[model samples]
Target: MVAVKITTVSTRLRRSMRAHDDYAVRVGRRRLLVTVTAHPGVARRWVHTTLWRHARRLRSVDGITVGMGVQWTPPFRAMKYGAEPRPCTLQLCVGHRCLVFQLAHAGAVPAVLRRFLADARAAFVAYGVRSDCRKLEEHHGLKVARGVELRRLTGMGNASMERMQCRS
Candidate 1:
C-alpha cells in the first residue's frame, strides 16, 4: 500500500447529512465510504482489492498512494474463552497500510479461502506494514480509525435522529 497527503478543503457547507454504510477506511486525511455485500468474507476481499485497484487513480483526486496487495494474518483464538470462539482476524497491505475486516468460521478452512488469506497476508507483508492489528493498535491507538459492531439502533429507514435504541 502507498500513502498520500490530504489537501482538498471544502468551503461550501451543508447541514443535510446523507446516510452511509457503517464500514469505511481513512488514509492520510481523506475518508472513504464504500458499500460491500453483507457477507464478511466477500466484503473483506472487496475492501482490499478495491483499494489496491483504485489507489493510484484515487491519489490523483486525493493526493495519496494506494497499493494493490493484501496481507492476511493467520487466525488465532481469543485470549479468554470457555468454549470455542469465532475467528476474528485481519487483512492488510491494501492501499498504503489499509487493513480489511473479516470473520472466519470454526474448524478447518476450505483450501480456496486459505489460499486467498495467505496471498493477502503475503501482499501485506510485502508492503511493509506490521500485519498484526493488536501490534498496530498498541503502537498507534484511535488514529485514522473506523469500526462497527452489532449494536442495537432504533430507526425507520434513515430516520435515526429521533429514534431511541437499546442493545444487549
Candidate 2:
C-alpha cells in the first residue's frame, strides 16, 4: 500500500506574543519555516517525486506559496487531549522573496518529504541563498529543498508561545 507523509513550512510574522502564522508566499519581513514528517522509508520516495516535478518552476527570486495536505498529527494536543486528527495538514512559508509548496499523497514507502525539500532548496538558491544541500539533507533527514535555513534555528521555530497557549 502507498504510504503518506506530511510536512510544513512557515515564517514568523512579528516578534510578539500574538504574531500570526503566515503559511503563504508573500512580500513581508519574517523567518522561513518548514517541517517534514513521514516514516523514513516512505518519506524518501515522496520527497524525490516532489522535487523532480517542481524544481524548474522555482528558478526565481520572488516569493511563492506551496501547500500539501497528507495524513498527519497536529504538533500538540488540547482540552480533550489527543483530540488532534490522524490525517493532519502541512504548510510552509518561503518568505517575501520565497516560494511555498504543499504535497498530499499516499504511500507506504518512499514518502514525499524528500521531493518537497529538494524543490525548496532550488527555490532558495534562486532567491540567492548560499546553502549546503548535503548538510541540510543530513540534518533534516529529508533532502535539502532550498536553503539550509532550518540549520539556523536553535529552538522550535514554528512553535509560538501564544499559539501553544491557545486552545489546541
Candidate 3:
C-alpha cells in the first residue's frame, strides 16, 4: 500500500473559503498529484503545466480512464421526472496522474478540460461512455470527441469494474 499526502494550496484562505486542495497519491507505480479546484484559472494552469506535459510522453495505446458522478442540487430532494441531475465530479486518469475536478462548484467547464476531451488523439475509456458523453454535453456543453466503452470491450453487463473483479 502507498501513502497519500494532502495539503492546501493556500494557507491564507480559510478552510471553508479555499478554492482548492492539493492531493499527492501513490498507487503502485503511479504518482497522482492533482489539485481539486473549481477555479477556471487554476484548472487551466494545471492542465497545461501538468496534464498536457505528461500526456506528451504517453503512447497512443495508453488511453485515459474517465469517471464521473451526478448529484441532485438539493441533497434530500425527491426525484422528479424529466429532471436532469448535475454532474458533481469528473475524474480523469492518464499515465501516472489523475485529476479530480469539482464540477458542482465550477459554474462552467474549463476551456482546457473541454479541449482535452475534444482532442482526437486522446482516447477516453469509461463505462457507459455514451451516457456520460450525453450528460456532459447536455449539462456543461462539453463534447467528448472520442471514447471507448469498457463494458462493450469486456462484454460485461451493468456491473462496475470493481464489482466484476471482486466476483472473479
Candidate 4:
C-alpha cells in the first residue's frame, strides 16, 4: 500500500470525550472503527469451495482495497479446561461490504481467500498489519508477500505534525 503523506485534518472541530479503548489512535497502529455491523459466517473445511466463491465476490469492484481484522480471546488457564473455546472472529471490509466470520479451525482455507489476502498485501490499508499477516500465515497458511506497514507511515505523519507545530 502506498503511503499518503497528507494528514486528514479537520477545521470544524467539535469537543468530545471518550474512554480509553484499543480503538483509540495508538502510537503503533491507526485502527478505524466500523460503525455498521459486519455480516457473519462460519468457515468449515467442507465449505472451502463455498468460501472461495464467497471470497471472489469480496473484491468485486475495482480500485477499493479490502480491510480486514480479527477479534479473539486468548486461551487462559481457567478457560482451557474441558470446554469448547470461543472461536476467532474475522472481520472484512471491502468497498461497500462488511463481513464477520468465525474461524472454526485453521488451515482449511479457500484458495480465493488466500489470493485476496495476497492482493491485499500489496493494495490494502490496515493497522498492525505484520501480526495480522503472520496470524493468517501461521493459522491459515496465507502468506502476505509484501505490503505497507501503516505504523511507519503514521509515525511519519506524527513527526511532520511536530515539526510544523515547532515552526508555528
Using lDDT as the yardstick, the better of models 1 and 2 is 2
Question: What would the per-residue lDDT of candidate 1 be over residues 47-133, giving only the tens digit for each residue?
Answer: 556546765754563333223222234436554543333324344333432433333322322334333433322232222233333
Per-candidate clashes, comma-separated: 10, 43, 0, 0
Residues 1-168, model 3: lDDT tens digits: 434454333222222327677766654445566566777776777677655575754345654454433333554676688766766677776654456677878877778889988876666778778877787788788788887787766777778866655544
Q: Considering every candidate listed, which one attains the maximal TM-score?
A: 3
Clashes in candidate 2: how many? 43
Q: Model 4, 96-119: lDDT tens per residue?
A: 334445454333455555565566
Q: Tell me each candidate's RMSD, in Å, in order.
A: 16.5, 15.4, 6.6, 11.8
lDDT of each: 0.35, 0.37, 0.66, 0.46
For all predicted structures, in order, the TM-scores are: 0.29, 0.25, 0.70, 0.45
Ranking, TM-score, top scorer first: 3, 4, 1, 2
Whose lDDT is greatest here? Answer: 3
